[model samples]
Target: MNSSQLKPLLSIGNKLIGFILFVICAFAIYNKVLQNENLNQYGADLKIQLSKIHWGAWVLMGCLMVLNYTIEAIKWKSVIAETNQFNIFQALRAVLVGQAFSFFTPARSGDYVGRTLFLAPGTKLKGITQMAWASYAQLLMTICFGSLALFWNLPFLPWLKWVAPWGAAFAVGLFFYNQNFKGWLSKLNILQIGTGLKWKLIALAFSRYLVYLLQYNWAAAMLSIPVTGLDLSIAIMALLFFLSMIPAISLTDLVIRGQLFLLLMAPFYHNDILLIALTTLIWMVNFLIPSILGAILLLGFRLKR
Candidate 1:
């Protein structure tokens, strides 16, 4: 087909894809919530306990979810500030839209497409490559912090302490490589952001990571999980760290997610259903709802190339 004819076809295809994704996310959410109502023999008991909890706690968690993504938007905005003209509000919109695309994609890579759409068409390709830098910064935070929690959890094996120096070496390697990469990209005119700014972005990533931990902790407290302080934090980090190791689509992840949460909390709290309740809340607040929001936002995307 001629480019002229092909453009219209592509626009129709894009709109169809958006509508399909919205349907998938919405259906998955509805199905899962229906399951919540008639979960099992324990459904009556679960609802009774859950009913006793104050509505305010759920409101606070929803607020924290917004704050969580806001921090992500800030990191994204800064990285592309040298190229894109997006304000923080626009950046946030991109993040949520990215979440929608990410809901079903492998390893969540569709997020790149979602975020890049916010850039001017001329710059969208460059924005994709540049966005990876911010992503890497957040991942490096997970590795560094998760590794420490790993070391703490494995204290019985003195040899495991060897992970410390390796983590240090990895950190040093990151510093030198970042410095070299910055200059190379500068020479090539690929990206002009500073090494210092990159580090600041990593700090912001950590702050968002902390917000995640707090939300989980708050949920546990509301359910009276009976685990707190360092014990709770350690298990939560361990759960997240290990969970990140597994790959699963958000829509299909609930069963495994709940199992992992149970395994991690088994040592501290044995109320299986309550722990599952915590898992359900975390998944819905952090992933499902935001994804649905993003899918709804997809309707606003310009269908034309």
Candidate 2:
């Protein structure tokens, strides 16, 4: 197909994918709320649980989330040090705005659009390509560490076992096949992907996962979930967050995370409803809250001219 013809076709495909994702998310929410019936039973009391949350703990979690974003911005700055003058504030804004887009859009292409806003107009595309590479590097590191933790904990759920290996392989393949990786490395004359600044990038990426652990731990604490022994919940939640990146699923993350919590923690908690509610609450706080704020910020402020 000609370039113009192909553009329209691609747009249609993207829209179709988005529609499917919405339907999936809607279905999951419906089933979780309606078919389960139990969710509704405690739906009233859920507000009480929320009301009981310690403001101090909530503030601490919010700070950690900002730290996570800052670390990501630093990582991106490291990757494109030569190509552009990386500003931490700009990077953080882009990251949060990108995250806002990720919440509702299928596959999170919104991240790219948000990141592009920060780039100098002339080199927006190049900056975007580099950002994609940096993201891929982070994903690879998360999967590698998360896999080790997954196997170490070896949760009671049989299906959970398959997630680690498959995720690891896919992440590795994605890194190797990434066009941006090749382009960035070539432009910078970097021979080894794991050398110098790249190592720092990976470290920053690891920090993001650690930050997530803190966030999840705090969420568990808020829900009065016991934190004894090695906490595998963080690793499992990280895995779910990673899975949410895959395109074509509507609200798959919201459902999968809630369901997985029940499967993995129910044996210990003996309260599936509480676990699911906690998971859902945490997801809403982490994803939905930021998205709403980002939308407001984007609308209220003007971009750099």
Q: Ten-residue segment with the worst summed lDDT in candidate 2?
A: 296-305
- The TM-score between candidate 1 and the true structure equals 0.81
Q: What residue pairs clash in candidate 2, if any at all?
A: 21-250
- Clashes (N, CA, C under 3 Å) per candidate: 0, 1
lDDT of 1: 0.74
**Model 1: residues with Cα > 4 Å off, grouped in runs:** 1-49, 154-172, 179-193, 303-305
Could you say which candidate leads in TM-score?
Answer: 1
lDDT of 2: 0.63
